[model samples]
Target: MAALITRTRARWFAVAAAAVTLPRAAALTARASALTRRSMLLGAGTGALAAATSAAPALARPAPSDGAWAKHDGAFAGVEFDGFKKTPSGLEYKVFEEGYGVKPTAGQGIKAHYAGYLLDGAKFDSSYDRRSPLGFAVGTGRVIKGWDEALLDMRVGEKRVLKIPAALAYGKRGVGPIPADSTLVFFVELVAITG
Candidate 1:
């Protein structure tokens, strides 16, 4: 499944306008940045990190071939993942649109949009409402565990439904709008990968 890249692929496609180069003098500050190498190293972080690999691994199971559903089917707020695939770390995802574009590697910057919901169908957050994608370094703990694990397997422009277990999410110490131990659901689309 391959085709020429199109501008209409995802919401709005845009890569970094310019490659950022941090001055050597900022090395120490960079080391102290939120994504420190010592803290991140990925797999060393948790079971979720075990999902990261050099190449995308085969999905344990794939969703229905039909791929005929909208993001608001309300299936995301439930625990059932009838046609989803499971990663080694317990993250469940259904890839509705395969982008066949460049897949992000560890430490690479990614731009993605997401709509987050709770198991009870309560809405929490969404990048769509913001009209801008979220940016972060994949597999570097800059985001939640499930996100870090899933993004590595996703290619730019791919859209997926993710069922994130509590362990791979905020866990017992849930953040605002999310109850403790609450599993999360998200309709995520990879917009771009840069740096």
Candidate 2:
């Protein structure tokens, strides 16, 4: 009787182990199958179909080259102003109010108040409407690429106007109210850095 009980316990343990291992083995097999299929498709010159079927976000439009900003003639066309600076990534900004405090680094949470508009002066979004500041991590792509690049240089209490090209803002597929390939203007006030 004692030997029978021990055998039963060992069998139950083995069964439980197999149950856990089987699912993981199945998942790995499925992943391998998908990769093999993708490889075959690529070799067959069906790269586009393979990419479309893959789990990557489709780029709505190609990003403009960094030098493309020089030739850009959009809403900000012919507008000249002093103190405006351009980043290497083509983001442009002018500080209106400078604040004194520690500047936020990448991955730090920041609170900011902002009103976003199209170049034609149509307001599309505002934190003021929600009666609260927008909060996001600085330089971590939590917001748009432009915001991530611009916020890094800002100090607490700083107010600035950002002229974001379409690629940095939303690419070709604009958000609800904003139109595709639209240039955006944002009046931003940094409220706090709360890492």
Best candidate (score: TM-score): 1
Q: Residues 72-171, candidate 1, lDDT per residue (tens digit)?
A: 5333322345657888889988764565556899999988888788866677888777777889899999999999988899987677778899999999
Per-candidate TM-scores read 0.62, 0.58
Residue-wise C-alpha lDDT for candidate 2, range 1-195, written one tens digit per residue: 999999999998877666555455445334433443212212332343234334222211112112111222234333433346888888888764445667899999998888787877677787766767888888888798888888888888666678898999998897899999987878777788888
- CA lDDT for candidate 1: 0.64
C-alpha lDDT values of all predictions: 0.64, 0.65
Give lDDT for model 2. 0.65
Q: What residue runs in model 2 are displaced by over 4 Å at the alpha carbon?
A: 1-83
Error of 1 at 7 (Å): 25
